[model samples]
Target: MKLQCEVEVINRMLPTFGMRNRGKGTRAVLSVGRQEGKRGAIYLMICTLKDKAGSRYKLENNIEQLFTKFLGEGKATIRLKEPALDICLSKAEMCSLKNFVSIVGLANKGSDAGTPLLSQLIPAKTSEIEKPRAKMFITSKKDYPITKNFPYSLEQLQVSYCKLARIDMRMLCLKKLQKLDLSNNHIKKLPKTIGDLICLQELILSHNYLESFEVALCNSTLSNSLKLLDLSENKIKALPVQICNFKELISLKIDENDLLQLPFTIGRLSKLRLISAAKNKLSCLPSTFKMLRLEKVDLFGNPFIQASPMVPDIQLKIPQTLLETAAREVARYRIPYGPQLIPATLCQDLSMAKTCDCGLSCLNSFIQIVVAMNLHQVSQTVVLVDTMGGTDAPIICYFCSLTCYSHFLDKYLQSIRD
Candidate 1:
């Protein structure tokens, strides 16, 4: 088995000899396998790119003692007896480390007894075990090397407090990148291409100069992969309605912004469980806001409008336009449509179609009513919206037809009269 990790060779007799170590460690590939043409002989190899000639030891009877010391969080130490050395491995995943430990233990047994261990220990080519894969990288300005290059194998990267104005193009090319933290920067705008990181799950962009969450990003592949998003302490004025496209989003933080309102279709984010919009300009929530089953919600320090009983207005029926009729039919039946298959403007109109409480789509022409709703109905933990400790807030409800509006009005009036 070949494992990529940071390796440090500590001489067991160095302290006794009154000598101090010169360097910390080097990124290297560790290989454990049997040598070819030599039966029942297992060899352990450590190779670093900087040195073509690497250290090798025969595990069969070469060791007086062996120790596997697991330091929590993907770090371990392997001590060899005869060599009097400590092989420290860091950034090695748990599974890989376990496999290595098992192989070394089996080799130490030196018995041809159990199922033949030689078959499992296949010799690796020099080219195959040269480059170490760096999966996790965290760097700050203090220790970050100017000439250091980011490994393509990186899965998580954090470069906070760097004062970067824009994202590095090289970072975007990391296809396997899953978590990225670029907080406390001077970035003013985000490129839509950030959504191309399909494996990305958590994105931290708090404490920046960003003015808006790019609408194009909401329409990208992030709608499926992104789970947590942080945009706090930014200069953002508003978020696009399409922000709800992230169906996998569980935690959303947009605190300290100038948001006027949330998306009316925010309930479409079925997986969302936590949301914080504290210290914003929101006075009320969307009618569909009650659809969320959030665990925690914070809307503190907002100027929420006082709640009052809504009085329904009876009006004549308005004829729906041909575009609106088509949009409704498309939305109702869940027809597959997009800009690639239809006009972009038509697609936009379809996307903006509203849903009535009765579960019918309405476009352009629809009865609109604002009613007070208790925020506690959707969230278990809610921050008080007003100093009065009241949780009721107004929400705008839409209806596809007069009949639907009348149906809702009847229920509303009856509930109030109770």
Candidate 2:
């Protein structure tokens, strides 16, 4: 999902696989069930099975030209270029499908062929059967409700593209849940009990209305195991310095927000491998941002001045493939650029120069008159953050003097709070 693609393709390939056909795709289900070990199941459904006539015939054997691997599932993350097929199957039914072979009339609509297949593969009564602990839980639909009761044994739960706003705090009962996705929702805040799910490793809350973090999320127990946190496409203004609580966080995405600045405490997350903070109002990053060995760092949309320390060696663009840990980079990537130049000086080019929050652009730099310049007790400063290195990070100030920087700082904070 990282590499943007059209949902129109899903519509084209699955014009019939709508809500009405959710659990009613009996023939389509059997066709997929018969090809348990055989690969290209998704490609077959998308490309080969164009219509009912296409799906009725058995899948071709010459699949050398066609290819798709069943990458291990985790939270049902569908990376770009990877085809995904949806189905609903109980654990027992899944166990029985391994030996199922496709029969002549089994996939025919309105035929009795499916009765024998189901009777043989699935037990009639699941009442007395002992259900296995849940490993993967997936439900994708718009306006889907989040139930209060969920199995504690679940390792992955994907409730993406739903209209859920508030998740029941009882979900913290899942002591073993590893991956949780509540993306594409109207959620404003997370439950305080979310901190109790210490086993959560990858949490995706992207495309929501979250303006800030839950106080309980700063707990060390949850931070110790939470590796990936995606908070992109939200209303977040700035991340608290307490976010450094995620001691094991490897990737952090706060893109598409109203963020004016990032807390210096982020440097405490030594395990952080990537930072996606594009499309924010940030003028500069924290001093310690350049100290880490990040695989990817995105700050393309920020109005960074020349004093910012972030080097331009890394590309701001997301790789065509998945992240390195999730993809194979077969070739070198040419990261795209989006105007990585500092604003012009007022004395030089007014057209390109950025005015200070105080409405004055520093045109001259000479002597220092602290008291006269409102610098008696001022610590805040402003300057153009450097996009390609050469920033004094220990205390990054984008201004030529401290007074203007301090003035802007107070205004920026107040704006975000409102």
Candidate 3:
């Protein structure tokens, strides 16, 4: 809603509070607009010069304080701050935190321009005082409202570290959007509708609770123009082979995930220039990795018992690329040596208990069924499965193995054909 900080520099994004000429002790104003046309309140700060020898670095310290304060406020005109970060800060830092914006319930007034903040510049209501004040509010930046006009001609939308968990499809219908960043949110899943952004080029959904990539359901255009895809620091365990469809990808980041493997077609990304799979559980790379047109790669902190000792030697250097390239040429015609394979019989330990006649109970992973189905119904149909009423009419069959389930399901489908 509002912020106070010491100004160390005069810049366009940050106003000098008309005190840039005042030098060292002047406060700076950072006024961010919500809508494209409207102006918002400015962040004012009183600069204190403890040591003026070098204060530019100290200006960044103010930015840090600004960040810490927004996170401290439980709610604000905009929501920011990760709750997990609070654990590491000391008591005094938390104590120094204060939310600048305020939230006022105005049922009679419109929700958008309903509550105008009262500060030094503007001290009255819109009806009583017609002066133009900054359109600002104190609300959860995480829960920041998305108006229909917010995405008008918008090309990039970044909500990183905003504590946001989901994309508002209504606001995401913008036709011009090229990039979307939702990093550092606690989001558990991505809306398949994200594929609807026909012009999207970059998708940064890093550092969240996402466990897997829903490749088949996403839109076709998403992969057509995408160049940078950062899914690093998520809970991804395995990626679908369809990810190779992102032929335009220049960089891919899947680091710090639970991933033990990548699709064999990963190397099919002919345009991929860089890939970072650091801090994952990968034991070996895909056999197709030899086909990658990569310029750089990072694969540190993995378990590769039978892997080539060259793993530790996989440093970022031109010579290493040449060496790997030469080796890749030799291995191109040979069978891929990476990505360990497990026999079907070894899949017995895992099972998915179910209530349907589709014989899905013995399946090992949802992706298996997702691959069979169109892949867009999981989120929509989960509720129906809970509310279905016809289950009382049947005698259920439980299969001991995936093969048995597949056999039964196939037989049942064939029987229906008769």
Candidate 4:
């Protein structure tokens, strides 16, 4: 197999000395095949970018061991014996890397298994066409590449200070993009097409004019890949309840917005660790605020309600409707009911099912109450919620049944009295 990738020849058995300390590799091509006219002998050849007569080694008895060490995405190190050399391959396409490694591994076994088909030894045409046209594109001078040579293979693209009122359609076509920064623009709305960037991990829309976090974005493939989202300095009044779909989100910054309250389901984001929502107009947190295990939480400058005496208002409708009972069962057991199995309205209602303190799911028939929560209990590093050195904030709670409410009332009252 022939693959074009970076190559590094390092002998760790040799002492670290002059000229070896740089530890950088060169762009090269690796080839694995049988030597011409040499029956039953496999050869591994590496050609540097500038040389054609590359170093060749006979695989029979020349290799003591062969194994692969993953460095990171798109990079790997192959260790070979006898010469005690490590061949590091960086910036290699994943498909090419896998094929190259497999061929060399089979050759090292010293059998006819080393003889890969003749066609398999040739580089794939698709790999040549998929070669990156560009890896990164950044601009802050308002010189956007809207019509010309837009980097199609870009993994990172920053188009800040461009005054772009809408997302560029060309950018959504970059399926390999990992980070997209459109900060300091005038964008008012995000295109649902933004979700086409299935590989995107960081999305920065700070200093924009956005008014709402669309549900389409939350339901997209981004729910799986997005790790960091910065929506700071926007005019958003409320985030969609579906924001909980960002299961992989780690850091969320919504500072200087007009948010009233976060989604009650946000606690479902099990990977979330950091949050910055300072200077918002939030009065109370969702009931599930205490469910988070956060590392850092910043709520300074927000108007959080002071702690009040616990009040229980038990309001439950007994003998729930057949639909409500079925919905609760589906939600509690996660029966995988979707729009295809039921009406769209019922599916929507089921998606919004509430969870009681007792861990059971409920719909419209539940008792509700309000209580104070100390922010310190939810996070390790917390900024004060108000100027009065207060950290207590009100959180709404729901109970699926009177039995669940009765069971929690004693512990809840005793804790609040403390």
User: Superposing every Cα of model 2 onto the true structure, what RMSD results?
Assistant: 20.0
- Give the per-residue lDDT digits (tens) of candidate 2, residues 325-413: 11121112323222344323321222222222343332222111111111111113222223554223222323434556556556656
CA error at residue 398 for candidate 1, angstroms: 0.9
Q: For candidate 1, write residues 84-178 as lDDT tens digits.
A: 88888887767877777677766777754432434434434555455545465454567544576677777888888777899887789887899
Q: Score candidate 3 by lDDT.
A: 0.48
Model 4 TM-score on a 0 to 1 scale? 0.67
Question: Once model 2 is optimally superposed onto the true structure by TM-score, how far is the C-alpha of residue 9 displaced, in angstroms?
Answer: 51
Candidate 3, residues 302-415: lDDT per residue as tens digits? Answer: 663342211122112333344334333333444333325534433222211222233222222211221111112211111111132211110123333345556755775686
**TM-scores for candidates 1 onward, in order:** 0.67, 0.45, 0.41, 0.67
Say which candidate scores most in lDDT. 4
- The TM-score-based order of candidates, best leading, equals 4, 1, 2, 3
In candidate 4, which residue pairs clash? none
Q: After superposition, how far is residue 10 of candidate 1 from its true place, in Å?
A: 25
The positional error of residue 54 in candidate 1, measured at the CA in angstroms, is: 2.1
User: Global lDDT for candidate 4?
Assistant: 0.79
Instruction: Give per-residue CA lDDT, model 4, range 103-134, as digits (tens).
Output: 77777777565464533233324333244555
